[model samples]
Target chain A: MPKPAPHIDILPDVPLRLNRCHEACGPGADAFAFTLAARLNGPVMWISESWTPAQLNPVGYSQYADPAQLLMARTKDQTDTLAVAEEALRAHAVRLVVTELTQPISLLAGRRLQLAAETGQTTALCLIPQGMGSNAADTRWRCTPVFHQADSTQARWEIIKNKAGTLSAWDVRWDEKTRHMLVVPPAGNRPGLADASG
Target chain B: MRPVDGPFALTLHEANTDRIYCLNDPAEGQGLSQGMGLADARAFCPDLQSRPADPAADARFLRILARWAKRYCPWVGLDGRDGLALDITGAAHLYGGEAALLEDLHARLTRAGLQVRSGLADTKGAAWAIAHYARGVAPPGQTRNHIAKLPVPALRLPEDTVTALQRLGLRTVDDILTLPRATLTRRFGTDLLMRLDQALGDQPEEVSPLPDPPSFAAQMSLPEPIGLAADVMAGTERLLAQVCTRLTQQEAGARALLLTLRRVDQASQQVELRLARPLRDAARILPLFERGVSAVDAGFGIDQLRLEATQVERLPARQLSPLHAAHQDKLHDLITRIGSRIGLDNVHRYLPADSHIPERSYTTAVAAYSDPSGAWVTLRPRPIRLFPPEPIAATGHRPPRHFRWRRMSLSTARITGPERIAPEWWLQDDSWRSGLRDYWQVDTRQGRRLWMYHTPQTPGWYVQGEFA
Candidate 1:
């Protein structure tokens, strides 16, 4: 049997997931990592196929300097970069780590991220292949593009995978304009549709 | 055959230039009859290599020589195509005498494989004339008599002017000097008298001493270019320290800083850091530059590092407020920190401008640099958040009860205005041709509310903002 991955203690009473995800996974994984970084107010490791150190910390974040917290990388590689990224994820004070190119991860990483988010704890977003699934996750999500309500703008969000939840999975919408997720009405309230207005 | 003693004229005419101006030739073909054209000159002497003229390269070489000559005198200006005029009044004594300095200049040029003629006089024109005309090296104080004997061409006048003088039977400068000054001025124009006056040092001619352009910048050229971010940070720190020292000496602080990285290939990468307030402290500056340098794309390697402070204001030693020294310092520190992170321009404080127009009354400028409180003015009540005026479709115009904004409808519950805001006739803006605006506060069914106004002059209504 393989030895359990050695874990570094980031915060008390927190479990860190250190695993690598495949590079084929695009920005859906990256968006999750960034969202967690903003929420955690500390460093998170993110491993992806094409990423520059510059893209991680944009000039805009300079306004919110060190006291506000910063994202940092401990170690990186093709297979284990995601694992190290997970190390950044599971802390109360520090929330998430995103790793790329390890054992195929699907619902396991998603569930862990969702669990952390449910408790208002820091979440880790793992970018793995489509088929990788584990029974350990609280929720598993697949991100896909959707049309914006007002204009021809296209936006994408995770396709929710939940083991225990009352919210309908298909009706969830993430508004890019307002940077918020809104529950789309089962029958959307379209005044324009009622009036037949262009 | 005896060689011409003392001095004789040598013109580097195109055809004979190569043969006569040959490097390391003991007898440099001077005085030997080689006529005007290259074919004729080559016929006179075989084995002549005709190199194409490179004027640009020749000019650059001359400038390099000029830089080296700064050791003799600080004030040096290039005279015409092939001449250097040095103001050696006080410097002559340092080189023992004018004769020794002239000898030294000749030897230096000779060692550099260049043939040169040098002269010293009270005036530049006289010295120039003596060097090209009378003697290869003129003695001090003898330029007046030496130049007087030379032809009018040696005065450095145009070819046309020389021809005109020759037409007037005035071939030599002595002939012009002997003519009445009024006659020379009237017949040949003021150019003749001007050149004569310049030679005798009657008129004051100014040499634009290259104004050491306000050295607002300090830089260092590295022995070898460096690519690492750490190296750039180190260079930035050094430059900041130097700049801070300069700022301190001037009792000033920099509000804006420009850090320039000159790469090995002569390409430039610049990072600009703007501060909320002018500060001279090195601690505040170094970290800002540390953040700035990290973003600089060090393509290949950076060979030169330069730091310039563009906007400067006096940084008076903070006079500790007896009431709250700590608070003021802390506020100043916070402004510096926040300004460093975001751009200084992004962080602003509102101050009142002298105008009646609601929008024009207040202006935003970098917070710490500008006064926060504005003067009290009696005018129309201003909205907390003035959004871009969105056009609204309404009926029965005094003030509509409800209007749609961003696809949401809001109904007016209260009307508080007919606030008359007039546009300043002195200042003209097409948009504010709106003579007056009557503002109203409105509420909506969806727990949303907004502030809308009616333009009385144009007779139209606009939704200005929401009560967030």
Candidate 2:
């Protein structure tokens, strides 16, 4: 019998890419990235292009990850931004390396980044625009924001591709009280909706 | 022979007249001296080959020579436009003795294609006189006798004073020393007596050494120039080891280090590394210089490598648990690597500022120099991202039912509050020019949430941030 495939987790020493479904889905992906980084052991290195205007606000970012633990680098172009991310990944001191690119990265470049992350045992997250070409990542995800009730912090995530080729989707919301991401169940399984006035 | 193997002189033109500034040995043998009128000099040797003198180039060469003199002594001062004085008082012992030291210096400089003359004396006046007129060492107690026979010009006095003294039949220092002190003072206006006393060691004179150059540096000069990156890395490692050892002995750490590579072609390239914290471990500091070493273009080859700790700080002692210490080390290493790649100024940490205005509530500070302290005041809800209050096309002082921001039209479905934040009057902030602001959290129909405020001072509404 053939050996079972190795289970893959979004663990340390793995490179994971989270591609947004659309431009409006960036905030949701960023929230997931921060939540993932919060579980790591070291600081997070965030590299962005100089032309990118979105900046991480400490006040809101402090809820998921310590703002002091976020080290940011703004590069002049996508090439430098990716290079900085690779270098940060190679450094074992950083637990996570997050890079945002306006353009798609080549397969070879993605492989190099994956190798660096694996060697250093660092978790790498690449945030790219929707419809970008394929990359050599252990897991590729597409995150989108879900419209919920007023004042609800809900986000939807779809595992577009995985190492085992398994695809799945989940609706999640950031629980402010617990400071954790809670997976929202299907409507039928939810408490109030399952049984009415029983 | 007139054109091929003849006398040559360098002429300088000043005040509409040409003068002989320098001449070859053959011209000197023909009695053509420096400062002689060109017409007269040509009369002496009609076959003279004369070229214009370049004083600027000569001064530049002199300055270069002064820099080279630093190899022998830490304190090398320019004696004049054509001379360098090295204070080798304590440093002479390293070369066996004062006489051997002078001989070595003279031989090395002469081999470098310079006409060298050296003198050792107890005073600056005596040294200047002996170096120019006598060209030998003047023993400490015998400085007076050594300079007695030298001409009055050796005293470094004005040419008019020398001429006036010569007319009085006092050509040598001995003649002036033998004269009555009061008479010498009255006749020469104390200048002659002062020079006499200074040369005899009766009066003290201080030699102002060149302002101390940067310290806390180690350098290695390779015998054979190497062009390989490995060689540069090895050289850097050796230099860093030496410098870090010294830093440890001094109980200090370096915050900034500069590594300089002197190429074989006399070009120097430098790589600067700034650390987020003061560090002295050579093992940790060596890797920070690896990328910089590879980036250097060792055209021809590199002959010397120098590492200088330009900025230093006192590292305070801290007690840490093993786990905590390891984590701190990891953080420091990460910060240092990122700082080296993207400059330390780009890396910053946010500190809570003591203010109520949303924009003024936090300040960005350089991570290397600041520590995050103080509690964050979270009395009111703040947006995850705060931007310059962008004016929204809203209707009135109350929350807008419909508005356009960043080319997106949104209809408000629910509103939370009017949190009033008063401006700090003492601080002059351009953004806070409007006195009072009433902030409201609004959920829009397009699945968007924004923090909009109405300013009573300006009577307008603006959207400042978005909640994620």
Candidate 3:
């Protein structure tokens, strides 16, 4: 019998296979991707080139995990930005790597990241604002803000692209008190939402 | 200037009274001595010419002269407040003989408008005593016999201690040496015995030399002002050459350098540059200053330029590499490669600071130089993306029902807090000038969870951060 592939539970019964490259995009994508980092072990390499007025506060990140576990690299231009990400993943020194790119990824660049991840057995999660383009990524998740009752406001997480052809959507809320993900059952996710395509 | 042969003295004010600090030979001839009250000196000699003494300027001038004395010997140290001590053990042959060296030093300093008196001996204390009491070179190994004839004060005792010795009918160093060692120590304390022993060559004394080349600074004073950028670059390069040469002799390198330019208008500007590694190569260090030097505003015109290495570290010579990257330090290589494009300070790590203020809670440290510390202190819920507080239009101490931020109208959907956090009274913070704040975590109807605070003292509301 063949052994099952290694994976991590992003939510209850929601298993995302590891050792591959994936993309998280849209409004609340940072929180969505940080949830994955909170569950993984070992040091994390995070690369970005954005200069927004506000920065990612480590205090706010304590609700998920210790921000000290992150190795942040602020690279120069687009080329150096992606080059660091590719090199870090290829090193396999870290278990998981995260990158926030300003522009959308092309199929060629996405394939290169995927091969590097496979060679080092590391998970590469790219946090992009643009929607999924023509890329050879294993999965593409889009998160959008939705108005709910109270503190645990539900953010809609829809797996718009799955290479395995498994498509689904769910309302995810983080229970801050327990440090756990509270996913409401799949609801009717509008098709026109992913149609915008960045 | 007063005539060289006139009666003159320098006075210093102390204990609410002015006293004579130094006196010329002519003033001494008139019975005016050091430590005599200025008023008493005037009563004793009506022709005395006196001026206020400046000890700070005199000390600075001595330090400069110490650097110049390095030409006679490699080890030159400042002795007391008004003397320079040079150890010329193996260097006397350069001037033919011991007496020849002293004659040359006295002649050179006399030509430079200075009163020079020197004594060469085997011991520092003996040499000091010989110079002030009897000026000449003591024959080698005859330090004990030579200084035995000097007075008790020549042993460098305190004024009261010397007076006590004189009251005992002891006027010469031989008088104090003839008494039993135990009896002398009991009568005058340990200081008198130690000075006696040091001058007799029985105890060794160390003369720590001054820092080599007067503390790693190179300066150029132009005859006329130069306003062009090229001229400033040339001056900076020349200073770098001198500073790097001194750094090599010390087996160290500069980590931070300050290049200061003084304009003819009396205004000055500085260009500060810090490096990731201890660097001595002028070629590598010069280009780093090019960016800051280009922005120099040479106001009316710059007349003087000085380059000082503010921070230096020991850096032994390493084998030159063709790419400067063949070394096996991976962490250093990573920082250098990224630090070249973005500055080295840009690569940083965030560490937790013990403070209740939102901005002061976490401190940023450059990752290349510092290590990240332990856990983040999270007692209450905090936002992930925080910035300076953005004001919102609202009233009362309650969360705003509707508000606008960055052109988006946000309506409060759910509120979870009124966590009251007052300003640290001990700290003067401009942001918390309104006193205390009631912070609220509001999940807006538009899918944004904002960390907003309301100030009761000022009756205002502001949004500080987002949970996303």
Top model number, TM-score? 3
- Against the native chain B, each candidate's TM-score is 0.51, 0.57, 0.57
Superposed by TM-score, candidate 2 places the C-alpha of residue B295 at a distance from the truth, in angstroms, of 1.1
Off by over 4 Å in 1: A1-140, A144-168, A171-198, B1-54, B136-140, B211-285, B288-468
Q: Provide the lDDT at B337 for model 2.
A: 77
> What is model 1's DockQ versus the real complex?
0.02
CAPRI verdict (incorrect, acceptable, medium, high) for model 3? acceptable
Count of backbone collisions within predicted model 1: 18
lDDT of 2 by residue, B1-468 (tens): 254468998899988899998787899999989899999998998999888989898887877887887777777778877788777777878888878888888899888867787888888888999998888788668888899899999998988889999999998999988888888778889787777778787888776766644367999999999999888988888899999888887778999999999999999999999998899999988988887888999999999999999998876546667766766776677677777777777667788778777767778787778877766656666677677778986657689888888898878877878998888889878778887999998877675667899987878998888776
Docking class of 1: incorrect
User: Interface Cα RMSD per model, in Å?
Assistant: 15.3, 2.3, 3.3
True contacts kept of each: 0.00, 0.40, 0.57
Number of backbone clashes in candidate 2:
0
lDDT (10s digit) by residue, model 1, range B417-465: 5666666777778877777676765544443345677886677888765
Q: How accurate is candidate 2 locally (lDDT)?
A: 0.77
C-alpha lDDT score of every prediction, in listed order = 0.57, 0.77, 0.82
* TM-score of chain A, predicted model 2, versus the true chain A, to 2 decimals: 0.82
Instruction: Give the clashing residue pairs of candidate 2, or none.
Output: none
DockQ winner: 3
What TM-score does the A-chain of candidate 1 achieve?
0.51
**Residue pairs of candidate 3 with colliding backbone atoms:** A60-B383
**TM-score for chain A of every candidate model?**
0.51, 0.82, 0.87
